[model samples]
Target: MGRHREYDVDKVLDATLCVFWRKGYEGTSYADLTEAAGVERPALYSAFGNKEALFRRVLDRYQERFMNHIPEALGMPTAREAARHILFSSVELNTRSPEQAGCLGINGSVAGSDESEPVRQALIDFRAAGETQLRERFVRAKAEGDLPPHANPEALAAFLMAVMHGMAVQAKAGFSREMLEAVAEQALSAVPGGGAAPA
Candidate 1:
């Protein structure tokens, strides 16, 4: 081996993620990353290339870990369960941690300066991938009679994605978990053949 590393890369990435989650990509600074990640400037730069590269890695980590709930919901036995689970779980995920209250991807990319456009687009693409999967899942559900015959799977997918993202926005605005759950319940109840509204 050429050299031994002193830091746990996973811990560093997690810390950096918390920083980016609280402060968007454009708002984060070199000092923020170094202090949060505990890697120092030189070592941080040498290992991760630059802030942009490091953020991309952070995004990957967020997707792999924090976003598992989406996939878990999508894999539910019924489409209605999928919808309800995703919406309710979104509220839990967004509000579970008080300090890191909002979504990392949304928090990072909502406002991007020109210099951070690439980071913004990357986040957009990541979000779109989840939406695409949701659409496909809904289409299959419709075909399997889980959704009403007249319901449009594409529109349903878009609607759910909108609600999900809106939960993120609401969470960032300091909405309580119960309040967000009510929103999610209303969303799921409104879905065509989605089941009875939560009581």
Candidate 2:
């Protein structure tokens, strides 16, 4: 039987999430987890199974708490507003901390090595889900006459996703908030209904 953990599991997991958020999966060693989680290696393994399994749990928590903006953006009144929300939110999250610049998911996806395929794929899948939600929202907008006749929701969704990923990379590369905001502005201009509604 596995030994019961004496530490606060949620608290430890939250700490572990910060380690992964800063260093990503491949970069986070078991020693790093033990030190960050305030637990011994055996205890971490006993509580969370293995490193991969523990990372999966951490990723889930991060998505739930830190990624709420994705859903909030999708639920906005207009598709243009939705895109604007997502773009700005991405910039905010990716650039808020020099200690953890760029997104946790994108950081993992970008930094993960071959041995970390599962971790990389998990981030990719999470990102794909966000794109799917945005695409569906844009599709609804097109049906409701919010978009021009020739606008393609699928392409627009892909474009926004690409721009977002680019923003993450740029943020990691030391671009400032003002620089990223300019990029967001350029992307917003391409949105079919980006302007204010008629009086």
Candidate 3:
């Protein structure tokens, strides 16, 4: 029979996620992951395949662990409330950990060399998926009269995502929670029919 693995996979992945969140995809090397995971290079490869594969796993864990606010925001009764929850929650998350004070999805691969194009694209797709969910939610809100007839779900989703991404960058740059909350408030004020009651 095959021997059992010695290291805990969940713990390793959690440590690796911290490294990636702090250093990003291209910036993080196998050495960084190995050091963070407290494992040897060969063992990491055997368990999680190449660096890219391991980074992908870390992204999944990040979404599962940190991005739960998106779903909760979508379930809000009003579009404005949904947007409020997402923006405020994002501010809390981005600034919660000073050691890794940015979004993994954004910080992971915002910019990279040609060799890292795939990783960059992966992050892009990951973010796009979230935007799609927001857009769909806004569409439902419009149908339910929670938003104005002229409200554009696509534009709203794109705008909200842009603000969220900007806030993540700002957080990484040492912006305070109050500043990010002000930014969220400013963004919320721009939403059409944002004060409307739910239908």
Q: Give each model a TM-score.
A: 0.93, 0.92, 0.96
Clashing pairs in 3: none
List, residue by residue over 41-94, the lDDT tens digit for candidate 3.
Answer: 989989999888888898899999999999999988889999999999999999
Per-candidate clashes, comma-separated = 0, 0, 0
- By TM-score, the best candidate is 3
> Which one is best on lDDT?
3
Report the C-alpha lDDT of model 1 over 31-99, residue by residue, as the tens digit. 999999887898898789989999999999988988888889788877788888888888888998877
lDDT of each: 0.86, 0.86, 0.92
TM-score of 2: 0.92
All candidates in order of TM-score, best leading: 3, 1, 2
Off-target runs (Cα >4 Å) in candidate 1 are 194-199
What lDDT score goes with residue 43 in model 3? 90
